[model samples]
Target chain A: MATAVAKKKKVRINGCVAAAQAAKYADVDVITAYPIRPYTATMMALAQMVANGELDAEYIVADSEHSQLSIAHGASSSGARVFTGSSGVGVQFAYELYSPISGTRMPVQMMIADRTLDPPGDFGSEHTDALSARDMGWLMGWSCDAQEAFDNHLLGFRIGEDRRVLLPQMVCQDGFFVSHITTDVELPDTGQVQEFLPPYTHPYPLDPRRPVSHGPQIMPEQGPPLQLERARAMEGAVPVIEQAHDEFARIFGRRYDPWLEEFMTDGADVVFFVQGAHAVTARYAIRHMRERGAKVGLVRLKTIRPYPTDRVKDALSKFKVVGVIETNLGLGSVSSGGVLYAEACAALYESPTRPLVVSFMAGMGGEAIVLKEFYWMTNKMLDAQKRGAIEKRTHWVGFEE
Target chain B: MPAIEIQRQMLPMFPSPNQGARFYNPELPETEPFVPGHRTCAGCGPSIQYRMTSKASGDNTILVGPTGCMYVANSSYLCTPYNVPWAHTQIGSSGSFTAGVAAAYEAMIRKGKWKGAFPNIICEAGDGSASDIGLASISGALYRNHDCLIICYDNEQYANTGIQASSRTPYGGMTTFSPPGPTIPEAKKLFPKDLARMMAAGHPHCYVATASVGYPIDLMNKVRKGLNHKGASYLMVYTPCQKGFVYETPRSIDLGRLVVECGLYPIWEWNPEKREFDYSFRPQNMRPVSEYLKLQGRFGHLHAEHIATLQKFANEQWRMMKVELPAALIRAADAKNLVDMASAEAAAAIAETV
Candidate 1:
């Protein structure tokens, strides 16, 4: 629905810089940063923005990501729109804060340029970093490209800061795929962003005049009610997310399905179920395969936590087989390794004629699942449909048998 | 003095109902700045300190709980207990976060984003969080002179993560990691880091004080004083943990008094403007270190020598505070004079042997 609006200005920039530009356009009030690869450029851009007087904000170069989030948590509680980002292990390094920030309902937004977890020390796009934190009460999702990344950053603020949702957001994009890649991302004017997202104001913020104790110690029996409240909030966020996206479209001329992005899934015999930049590639593969008259499609999951199980089950119920592409490491997990396989299988367990799903370790270590790999995965799915069973639990896309 | 006239007032024969020892939770506004139903442990002493702290700050207050037990346990499950606005900072970000909150309020109030008399910005940090991880950041906030109050609830050990020895943990105390064994007889051999005094000595321009929960009125009064101070103020309060201290829950406040009376923890304030220590406050009685040690299992393993060493340390603390020790206290400081486990033979030895 986005229209070409009055000859857009073009600028050459990387993914990190684009994210920084999005944060700048969002008019973030406080920026907390700790240097880590890929995502560091975003903070570096913000630092320059602060220095050049392009952004009138408090730029805090924190000692660590733990400190960075704490600063953001503090700043946001003081009613400032805060921006922070981390990459790979840097995200894990700050794992301690994920729940505390959300629990306090500070609505802090963090941009994570997904990097492969260490052991081999590869600085590449992988979902393992952010995926590890999916269960921590944060609104987590990944963007497929730079424009989506930019849009997601703004939407994340809107969704997280919404009174009904009041949760922290982990807006992720692949490290090199989206974080380093350059693309034409239309920058919304400040007025449009303002209309799309209101200035964050918590009802009971750390205001001295109306002192409230945030995150105080509670007894054991008291824990369930609070957790139930958080659960209710997550479940309640469905309509809010839709309304936010609808509002974003009305104001910014960019339309997005709040939950799942489906491509040629109607009447498809097999579908690729996945998230992030690889979904873009899968879509391309789907198009190529469809041209050859092989009934194939893609179902890109936009939101992971608050996991959209009902919508996913509805979408994939008709398909004979579903291939799950996992760009993450699940170490010793079931389904021969990847985590999404478990999530997808579990989500489909109660469905009528549940699809024959096979886990594909296609994007492990950030290796791009090439066109051939997609075709290979699709063939595996097709084989499962025809044979009524899968030969193996998982298939490493690029590596030989 | 007129004893007859004093008696004519018909005071209660026992401790009077209105005596200083009695606790009356101030006629606090119905507003609960720090509300109940948090994730803190049952009978948590530090949480009690937080409750008292926020109650003193009242409606117009911003609380900053740095990363520690308070931030973790209290704010768990995304349900905050704060009726007012409270934020959690990193264990090390207490001072800096507080400074930001204070700065934000100053700018907001001035810019008309908010309109009110400046709210009391208070940062409540645990001893481990404050004295150890957060010391430099707190020092930075104090040095920057932010209009805030930073209270280090000194429960000695890190109680939230089970009992662990913090820099503020006293000598001869037994923590999980600092257990008493045959070789290392005195569990924690090193003396506690003189944290509050160090804060006062380092940040002389800021209002610095040491308080205990035993003196609630004094604690509340100090909270008000810190809020009223034009610049940053630091208060390291002795809030005993019944769990970590291995004492009866009801004795939590009692330990606070015993800690000060034993001279292990001194209660005083530093007058920034006058540039002097105010030793105006005093405990009711001076007691031996054993009186405090006997209450907690952490100090149970200490031998006579260890107790004497602690007593010597307490004597040195008394001297630093310029408190003139009585002869009894000086006699209590000597190892030989102090009663050992088998020392009943010294006097009144006509005992039936088991």
Candidate 2:
């Protein structure tokens, strides 16, 4: 068994190029783009792909993010594999179209290279852009590196376009950390991608041969059923995502946990709960802590949309203390910290032996949680466990006293 | 990979079943894409325009409704009047969504994914959506030259939200937001944006035209013609609103004609090929602006001077259309020949009695 990069021809590329390469392999029919850092780099690679005759597709430089998403939704509705992306507030700019794209069951794939929101403009990773639209019925997840980013793009298309789970997907990566930084990515052969992802054929498309009305204004009574259907699609995507990963592994030779990736959690008492690219750094920190016999592990959340709630609860229940990482802003939210802390708290609340859950506002505004900070956070968790009562609900990392 | 050859032909335009000189109602498709049974007001001008536009497009069409009267009124309670594939988009998404649909079909057909002649992608945006919020988006679509028809159904006001004045609301037009008060007698101070012409000037490649429900044949023909054009096409159809315009429901079509005839609404097309204005379109007879305004209760508060101002505005429209102004129309523009509406005077007189 070869590593994913070793099995195929690996190329040193940034996250943006990896996304474009995946779109090329997927044979995306339409690529709508609105330039915003660092997602703009993905569009640049795609523009070159179209220009070089590498991909026979429509590359539309959209007027705005709202237009970009609308274009994606419309393209998907017309039964075409559409790819589009945005970053930071640009994602929020197109927020209005998110629900309609999914509600109509258009499996449009968006590459969100995370960036901080406005006022003090910063081109850095923050999950708030994609996380805010989590409940919009899109199969959402984050990639830890360029290789996983490429792999996730392919897998996202396969799972989203599945007949049982017709939904849009958000394939996210950290802005400068993942998008701009170059890494080794194994570009799969076109034949393998073809086998994994079938040509998308929506049940009800805008076709003259078969006329069907989609996204019609429904009755208030009908709202529940339509919502339930969307919920079912999100819920239904769990097995489909698992199947996509299994099939993806068989074809591309990269096996990944579809929900949570537990790193050295065996007989561990405390675990760090995180998502996106930070997990890569978290893995190194966990290994160092394990070497020191600190009994600390890492739990990387993969699919955040369908949430894998039961899986999360089961996995976190094994640990004595769970330190949730807050990378995105959620003002006035439960836990009054990042958005993920609330989700983690709720998932762990139903546990019989609830872990001492604490939120650490780390890696926000694109600052990486360094090795020393991880150790400091682990000590805080250890103190909470030793005292048998949590010191505080949340820690602002460097800011907190 | 082999290239697929899709048959590209215009849907043969047939003459009106009642082929009378006037009211020559073209034989509309029996398969109503915008069907009855939905809650559009009786004699809804925009609704009529919708039915006509969809009919012209036939079954092989995708209607994109922006947030406006058409979206709220037609597709209420999950019951869409659209039998053909339709989707509602944000008000400002009118052009972008339609562009997407058009772009999708282009890529799909070219890539040999979806086989068939390209579906007629159409956007039925309200005046507010088109003139204000969605202007830039529609401009973008037209500039990109997406093969779609974006019809800005101009009812002048935001009819769905209880008649607020939109950018398309004409000078002296009264609405809930533009009521005549002490400070401002001319309810809506600004002139209506020449949206269709702006579209034509900005995106010259697109086929742009102005039509009204007043001329059913012309409106349907323009719809078909716009759809026929390979590139983007914009048609701003003058849809009279009974609720917003404070006009009699039965006179919806009548107002349509009156508006055009009085030169308030000019009927013309922009020939993208020739890069010229097609001023060949003409109403039957030029009428006085007073005659057009008198039918609507919204204009009941207008004084003689306001009516004269409207006549001046109408004169400018006629001049823009290159139509010779009739002596009577010129005379009406003078304040000497005008008087305040009797209703306005009656209301003014009843102040103390009340």
The digit string of per-residue lDDT tens for model 1 on A277-386 reads 89888888889999998899999999997799998888888899999899888988988678999999888988987989888887777777789989889888888989
Local accuracy of candidate 2 as per-residue lDDT tens digits, A1-401: 11111124879999999998899888898999988888898999989878877787889988999989988888898888999999999999999988888888999999999988874458878888889888888889999899999999999999999999999999999888899889988887766877898888989888877766666666679899988899988888889888888988898788999999999899988999999888888889889988998999989998898898899999998889999998888888887888888888788888997898999889888888899899999999998889987888888899865
Candidate 2 chain B: worst-modelled 10 consecutive residues by lDDT? B345-354
Residue A344, candidate 1: Cα error in Å is 2.6
> How accurate locally is residue B263 in candidate 2, as Cα lDDT from 0 to 100?
90
Q: Taking the candidates in order, what DockQ does each have?
A: 0.21, 0.53
**Which stretches of model 2 miss by more than 4 angstroms?**
A1-8, B11-20, B24-31, B342-354
For TM-score, the strongest prediction is 2
lDDT of each: 0.79, 0.85
lDDT for residue A22 in candidate 1, whole number 0-100: 79
| lDDT (Cα, tens digit) per residue for candidate 1, span B1-354 | 111110001111222221144356444435567778876766577887887777777776777877777787778755777766677666777876787676555444443455657777789999998888878778777876878899999989888787889998899877776766658877787788888888889989999998888777677667877887888999999888766777777787788789989999888999999999998777889898999988776776667778888889999888988899888778877778765422323111211110
